[model samples]
Target: MSASSRDRKFPLAIEALALSEAAAPFSLRLGQGEALSLLSEDAQSLSLFCDVLAGFASPTCGKIFIDGQDITSEPPEHRAIVLVSPRDPVFGHLDVAANIALALRAKGAAAQLIDATVKKTLALVGLDAQNGHRADLLTPEQAARLKLARALAGAPSVLVLDGLLNELDLRAASKTRDLVTRLQRALGLTLIHAASSREDALWLGGRIALLDRHALIQCADAATLMERPSDARSASLFGEANLLTGRVLEIEDDVARIHLACGGVVEAMADAELAVDALCILCIRPDRMTPLFGALAAGDDETPPLVATIQSVLHTGEHIRFRLRLADGGEIEMRRPLLQPMRGVTQGALLQLAWQASQAVAFPMKDDL
Candidate 1:
């Protein structure tokens, strides 16, 4: 289905949001109760986007609409958006309960209501045990949770989390992501999580919006974005990809057979039409390419195989990475689980590699290149 149709199904919670900085203008739309992982490696850019969403910064162009209401010009207090930044402040002198209740007090909530809300928010975030402890005495994880609790005190419609999971270890990050997902569903909140790495965005497990040079590059689910990226930049965002320049030789249904400049023929699933002899690029993940042992297996596999000499091997804890040089001097990398048996696989060893057509993506070559 088209993006417009998908957007219609999920009503807009945040629409036409744009922010301008020194680099370029970025714009995006978020659906209700949907979690969007904004991918950007630049800390400043991430901060600017969050600030704009939280009304801490103003956009030079575009408007922000929430629940069909224009809130572009509204102040932070009235936008019903909560921002939990990595640098979120806390009152060192105050206790956990008091810090969580600060927003309620600012909104002129009654003392009794503030206390009730504070208790509930603390318990909801699993921080009730530290209610009476000073804010400064809390650990980094606990402090971060307190900040989230404070943000939730107002029951904001949209939650903007800026690199909250960036500094966390893998296990902790997973737990935090799960907690955020649970809270989003329970509270019916629209969550916008900013991540600096592709793994972090994928770990969040929803829609991902890739931002580069202050521009929104691509927005799609993890699998779709990896399989059918719009451009080289988008394709490279998901880690190392085996990209080769080639020319379309023929088209059969949804597959396009291409002859690579590096001296190999490959077939890839094509999502767009391409003229014969047209230059294009074939992209496939290293892990998708399987290494064939000994002679070609006696099977119905029709994928063209290439022989390469293993140039280097790197052990990466759970996996082993091999750098190989093909007969035509083209270099490629492949990764396999360390647990996988490799009887004769070693540096300087000849290995055959092949991948199915459906596992590769083909994109037309750009004129600029």
Candidate 2:
């Protein structure tokens, strides 16, 4: 009935209807004007539930599909999927081994089957030594680890991890991601991970899909999506992007020279176009814009012409981020090795901004939809 539903008939990894949500007894209808007030309250609650279910809303009025198979009529049980909800509680009395067994048993698994799954999942979660410890007695980290193992023991074709990682500490989160990555690869599983953190989504390399107000807006591979989102919602969701308001002043070989409203001329490859009155936002990734070195004295190939001043440096374990201010007051982020000599690139001191022509990505930006 909706444009999105029709568009999805083509081909997709997953598809949903005009999925909506609201509080009970709200009595709202999209076709009726009387439901306008109720729409606001219902929309937020429905959106939250959809997010918790990894983009599945309750009482789906339309067909659903996965990998070209119609799964709308099937209950969650027959879908070869494992869904962990916020309401799902961990048993405080059971130990790690017992917890795994209990979950599989509840799914109607035989005793022998449950035992084997528990052992394999426990080993997967690095709980070989803590298998005997009571689940209540284990630390929060261990308990959380068990929860993942329980969900994974079934070896479901699809793993729908909602916000479980949000509750874990950095170390615990990193450990969980590593294990999930290994399992996903080993089992050839399709993972639909939902997170508010852009970094988390980016790290789970695959396709990145952006959902805005219950509608799937944009989806693309990690690198391509981050570097160039289809619109504003996607551009912002792809982590750090510089949204510059400008128009095409000139077009060169595969590049367009843009004149920013702030009176600065910048150049990026011309991927799309806009009329004289059509406003556009240029989405540029900070990492793509590296600090260019000056011209090499005698045939030095690495020196670049654009100059910049380092405003601050954020030291990450594997990478160091240098926040630089361009000569025109615009800022960009550059990531380099932690051990690299960036100490001398102090704040207010000038440095060159250089990047290959292929690194920059251009996207057509629109207002929030």
Candidate 3:
């Protein structure tokens, strides 16, 4: 390879990698030395996508690239891509250290090198003290970490994980996530993680490719997806987003004034092309919504607070989630912290809901929504 080719930032690019004939071809670029997460509600699709990346499954019509080289048809042995998944098997006959060393050895790594890498990876995954322990005797957390250690021992070009952390408890998963992130940064490894939930995707923290069922919905940063979702489906994936159908009343720069189908007119930030009187789907996060107290803040009278009765409240320690029934009988949700609870946030209490225009996003109305 030329010096320039070796030094250039080589992104892992996937162009139209379709899992099935009906599943929309998945495409994304995991930038050099950073992590990217494929988020989806479908576990099977996520696994298939990761399998394609790991060269274990064939794409109907697509190409995969690593270090600017097409690896579309490369077999697992030649791809230099490793996958860690819940279904990954452990060699019960092999000891902890031997399990990790096996992959490096397969790559024809020197004995000294394999031994060194195995020891270092064990420490990195917090399994250094268990190097001689039988792999079958490991706890769930240890087994998960061992999987990571084994994958890292080979020093893969791209590491693809299929909800590997989801196999552990909440606390263990959080810790393992942090460890994986640190390892990736320290090694300058290209990481692509598959997550079944938005929280998992958000925690992974690079770029997010959201897949609904099997189709690629949108690929962007967490803030972009949250505050400026491409559609109602994307918005709903995030926390408790309140979506209401509406029509564009006017366009003011990047923000659009919308008249709701339910009964209010509110302003929302429009990141997409929107013309006057166009159909719109308004998205506002429950956390961004507030209950109006005393006199309402002066703004747009057409966007007056909608009167609603709190139907139920769920306290999640950090925040209180409320289910409210609007005047038109439509339900809208509001979530707020306990430190600053609304004056009448209790169940059956009447309240006026308000939210800032900047906190809302407007997407073009679609039948899928």
Candidate 3 achieves a global lDDT of: 0.81
Q: Write the per-residue lDDT of candidate 2 for residues 1-369, one digit (tens) a residue.
A: 654454333222234454554211111111110001101112344334334233344544444444345555676656655665454557878777887888677778898888888888888878889988888787666776777788788775556665566567889888877877786666656566665656666666666556556555565666666666666556655646666666666666767666655444566666665433345566566666655443422322332245567788888888888877766787767787766675456666767654454555444545452
Q: Least lDDT summed over 10 consecutive residues: which range in candidate 1?
A: 296-305
lDDT of 1: 0.77
Candidate-wise lDDT, in order: 0.77, 0.59, 0.81
* TM-score of each candidate structure, all chains considered together: 0.83, 0.67, 0.87
lDDT ranking of the models: 3, 1, 2
Q: TM-score for model 1?
A: 0.83
Candidate with top lDDT is: 3
> Per-prediction count of colliding residue pairs?
0, 7, 0
Model 1 regions lying over 4 Å from their true place: 1-28, 41-44, 293-307, 315-318, 326-331, 337-341, 367-369
